[model samples]
Target: MCSISFLVLILFSTNFFLFSLLMLIKDFCMFIEWEVVSFNSCSIVMTFLFDWMSLLFMSFVLLISSLVIYYSKEYMGGDVNINRFIMLVLMFVLSMMLLIISPNLISILLGWDGLGLVSYCLVIYFQNVKSYNAGMLTALSNRIGDVAFLLAIAWMLNYGSWNYIFYLETMKNSIEMEIIGGLIMLAAMTKSAQIPFSSWLPAAMAAPTPVSALVHSSTLVTAGIYLLIRFNILLCDSWMGQVLLLLSGLTMFMAGLGANFEYDLKKIIALSTLSQLGLMMSILSMGFYKLAFFHLLSHALFKALLFMCAGAIIHNMNNSQDIRLMGGLGIYMPLTSGCFNVANLALCGMPFLAGFYSKDLILEIVSLSYINMFSFFLYFFSTGLTVCYSFRLVYYSMTGELNCGSLNMLSDEGWIMLRGMSGLLIMSIIGGSMLSWLIFPTPYMICLPIYLKLLTLFVCISGGLLGYLISNVSLFYFNKSLNNYLVSYFSGSMWFMPYISTYGVINPPLVLGSVVYKSFDQGWSEFMGGQNLYNKLVEYSQLVYFLHNNNLKIYLLLFVLWITFLFSFFFLF
Candidate 1:
């Protein structure tokens, strides 16, 4: 495990070195005497690594890759194609690094598309048809982002701001700027699986557990949130920014609600991911960039930890992932259950854990946004929904009566998996200290009303207690219809606009092609016209066939003579 992590560190170090070199060349090219040569050289460097944004993204790419590599060595034991899995995972990380660090619009485009491609491959690493279909669905669904990013690249290139620095400096007030912003937001929406793009994420659980942790929790989907944060200056001033906040708030509410009903352990976390992203997006929408980033940092720790724990549970339980099959795990897998319980509590904003500080800030930011009452209600409701579902996650998996599967009656996981969870647990406990200065920078601490902090704690605890009540075994059967209504209809079908926009982009051509193909199978005459023509040709050519067969040698000579005559005729003509 240590060796694997060392290799990942080396991989990131080399990639970062390459990016730094490209950046230096780009800077140098700006002042060289040979104008055309300098310009072309700069363009190449720009296409590689030319911006502060990419540099910022590199930190996340490296951090998450290091953690995941350490994780895989233990999680994927005895799995075939271990080398292939590592290569693909590395490729995914590299693609994200490129996407984040590319200096030119075209390079950014490649990185963007490359991340999508690599993620699709990783999603299907299991070689199961279900995983493959999930990968295909994920790829197809996100193609909407490709269109948007491609358009943004084309627009920027045409505007003479194709380079990263040029784009940041010059494209501010141009009409193309707004177009680019809109395109970028569209891409972010799809990449993050916001609203209508949400289903693909739950489906993506077909991947291996480690992939889910990396993809949903730590890295790939977060890239969109990172994009929004990096461009907050540009987006915050526009209506698009406000729209993102509203959409993000709604996504949080629905995702939280969805998690309430998810029985699958991984899917529950997947929904939590959507909810957490929604919260980050909502905070970002309000121009609280630092606070949003703080939440993002804290979220990465707790969510990744939670997902890793889920992976362990699934692994030990003969690959069973449904929480319904899980209960009393705290008795069996004490270390894992303890780590997960702590993470879950922090995830739902328990006090002192990293999640509390970050989540409360999001609520505060939401309260400050000048949204309508409906939006306000949604935000508040989402807060309650968050507590309820998060508590359910803990109760269903850890605290309930023991109902271990025959395969996982009692077992222990490898040290590598436990190490990842332990690392996250430590981060969760002490990570909030990094932001302590943000809350209390001076020697003298500025204190909020005790009641208010207590109120915040009260709300969180009450929400958790309510969730426990709602998910208690005795009450579960009674909540079935309510659960279906909330998860299936409200969570899944609620994103009418985002859904149409996300799916509509890919559906039209594919649906048209499907219709065209299906028509051929509908028994229409035109569909069978080619077959009829072939049959008629065969019938009419029977005399020719018989004449040829009657004298095979003569026919061969005649055919050769005809071919020679045809070539001679063409040449003469």
Candidate 2:
């Protein structure tokens, strides 16, 4: 199965790269129709991937796709349409490949839309009501981002450089570039789900574990960041760069808070993914593309391992998803539990683990960058929160109560699943420095090993302490609405339209959000304007008919004449 899946994935990926190469060749072979519009008269058509950014992105795409395919076999054993699943997954990978390698705006759009469509299908592949609903919401939210991206691309073509080659070539020209860059940044923020755009991610948890593993951790969620880093030249002078930094920092902060309150295990991971993506965005905004890509690599290894382990837990317990109901099974499922704990610790950036190196690098980048003091504080606070929640995740389901009714059993899944997860965990523990060396050329000593170890230890310990306190404290009970107060006002209530049937201790933001959504969706202006126009038209037509109420015979003659005119008009057509 591993060999077969590898072949399928590699074949599809190779096909996309080869096809893109052919297109590039064809563009080069064609005669140039040069008409001088500005500095250079060049045709807009182009396709090339002979660049560092494209190569790096393609490597990530290929690596993650192959891993997910291998992991999916064991996780999706009994599912029907396995072949179709693999096919769509390959298509999804290909779309992203096209997206990253596209040399022109039009080609990029083609790849972007293709990826989005295939991603939507993968989200809803389960064919259930919940999955379908989540899929629709996911698709709808992404479409909003897609609109912004399309508009930005259109703006780029119209007001800025005519050719993408020239756009890249002349990216340093400050003023004109910033305008285009700002639009792209707006699009990126929406696509990556920074702060206000983050609610859709938790909703997207309804997708299968492999889908969640690949898309949430490594591919779809990171596309925006990739675009930003790839076009760093365009964004250098724009205020959009600073905006991205602030938004990303804010997103990391809020996402940490949201993860703290989520009862569902996957939702917690989903929230954490958002936070991590935010951190990556922050790094990219600071012109730390090397650090951003390195973090991306490490994050993919650990997160995919974490998701697969969550999948095993959910599968073993008859599809139980709530982490609140689980506890104390660490002894029973030692392998799975051990692997999960390692991944979580790495995620929380424990020293000697993978997350420690990558996360510390990000912190270093933040400190060195020209970001504002307030922004720095936000990121630090969020880092503290991340450590808290990551620790909670380790202790809650694996260490605490373990009493998940009758279905709870601490046991490992098939060897295939274990093998996949174990490999990922090992990679996470060591993936950090390898990517760092590959990406970062210069070495600057940032912090002492002792201090780094202490930071990780401190964060993990504090998180555990917080979890213990929350579990024991009666009055200070945890709740998501209060934790994600802002999201409750926007995505959780407005976009989701959750019905409020009960009223005890309701969250104010959610309540206000629901009311606002109703007002907008059922507003009077739209109905009244259309109704009034239609009524006036009908009334005038009736009045005109009434004025001609002279004779039925005359009316019949006029109708016959009108039919003749219609026939003549048809004959002319």
Candidate 3:
């Protein structure tokens, strides 16, 4: 694992530099698609896109994955299945690459499906209940998107080509194109864990930390956003676009609130991821694909680093995941703590960092756009809540009193882990400004009121203050009405999404199945189908035998009795 990771790391670093130079020379260049299957009207082509966007995304995916595989060498040391882990991560990277470069729907589905399947395998690699459940959830949730993709391909059949890039301009107003846009939007939402489908992402924390760092927080979740980025021009002024804008705002707000209430160390990070994804989706809805792409890159860098740091902390804490039991680790593990704080601050969109360059610009864009009051409320509140939870997280795990049982088992120094994190940590710090320069080349012209310009700063400061005060209070004893059973339970369990998806969506069908089995299949079908007919036939046959009379004298008497019986039957009738 270590050797492979190191080799890939060096290879991608070189590739990245070369791509950077090439991008400077040419704005965009696409390879001629190799024809796979040519039909009467359409052909399945395997093509590669090598624009700056795909190149940059692929470079980052490779970089993070290499570090993750390298880090897994130490974190997963002594495990029997460590090799399998590394191989899965490698396959994941391959899938991400395929998704990034593919220009046709067929190849895109190949990549998308690969990611969903491989991630499920990774999630269940632990062979425990939690891993099993999480894997199922993740797989099933993504399956919805896979179906959506297949539907999209079927819909594209009307356009006579699976290469959607060609149709983006001509098909924008066609009614059939609306179906395509809506299906693609639906697919993107599921893959990105938006709204009702979002339960899978945080639950997917059951995967090992390296997997979470490489897959969930970065590549897999961003696949949807990337697809939408490529399809952005088609979505303008469409109903799907408007729906996406609304859903994204709600998703951001929901995930932010969920993060505030979450206690699991990994899950908090995961929920934060969901919120950021919402932000990206919302921005994309507003027709700022470049900004979404920018934030996507920056978030990948820091979120990957953040998860890796969390992995380090969890390793040192003897495999414990509860934040309530963790505190004052900064004193014992300053290096890992420093990385965590850096990532956290970056996540909160701290000044001049990677997130700030993209996030601040995104907020400014939203402010400048003509949007409804509801959307504006969701946008700003989610932004402020981001700061609140970031501070809350830092205080709970890094600054409060040490509650972990023993220091003898804690480990602070792991050179492999630190080395793995170093690459992304550096990227997390400078990726935004670097990409901002490379991507935009020219800055966005901003004309806003002074108050609007300072809103981000004000939101950050106020949220941070509230975060400190809230973290200091006793949450269970805060004595607020929202702490009641229904409200607290709803918020704590992510608005009962687990129940809605598992019990609500899945169990009802199972219950109906049982009913169908017993009532229609077992009872009525059994009696009415074969058995009742056979019993009636047997009874009538037995009675007919008595009337048939075998003896000759008995035959005479039987004939006479039959005549009398016929007379009596007629009279009775």
- What TM-score would each prediction reach against the true structure? 0.79, 0.76, 0.89
C-alpha lDDT (0 to 100) for residue 491 of candidate 2:
38
- lDDT tens digits by residue: candidate 1, 1-573: 346654666577557546545654464322121223356337233345434235434654566566767777888877777778878877777777766655556766776788889889888877788888788878977898889888887887766556644565466667778888888888888898887677687778888888887787556788788777766766766788778877887788888877776688888888888888888887777777767777777787788788888888888887888787778888889999888888888887877898977787666555555667776777667777778888887788777675753554556657888876776688778776655443334422235566644555667777888888777753455755465564456554444443554467569977887887778644465546876777888887996777767787877888999999999999999
lDDT of 1 at 100: 66
Q: Pairs clashing in candidate 2? A: 327-401, 327-402, 328-402
lDDT of 1: 0.73
Q: Which candidate number has the best lDDT?
A: 3
lDDT (C-alpha) at residue 331 in model 2: 72
Q: Model 2 off-target regions past 4 Å?
A: 1-3, 8-46, 158-165, 169-175, 406-410, 447-461, 472-573
Q: Native-vs-model 3 lDDT?
A: 0.87
Tens-place lDDT digits, model 2, residues 1-573:
545877666565565445435544453322233333444665445464545446545655675677778878887888877788888888887777777766566667777778678888988898898888777766766777688777767767654543455666555675556666776677677678876666667777888898888887667887878777767776554576688888888888778776766678998888889889989988788777767877877888889888988988888867988877677758767888888888888888887688878887677656656668888887677787777777777666766556666655457756778877776777787777755655554665764456543554565577667755554452235653467577655532323322321132146766887787676545664456766778899999998998689988878898999999999999999
Instruction: State the local distance difference test value for candidate 2.
Output: 0.72
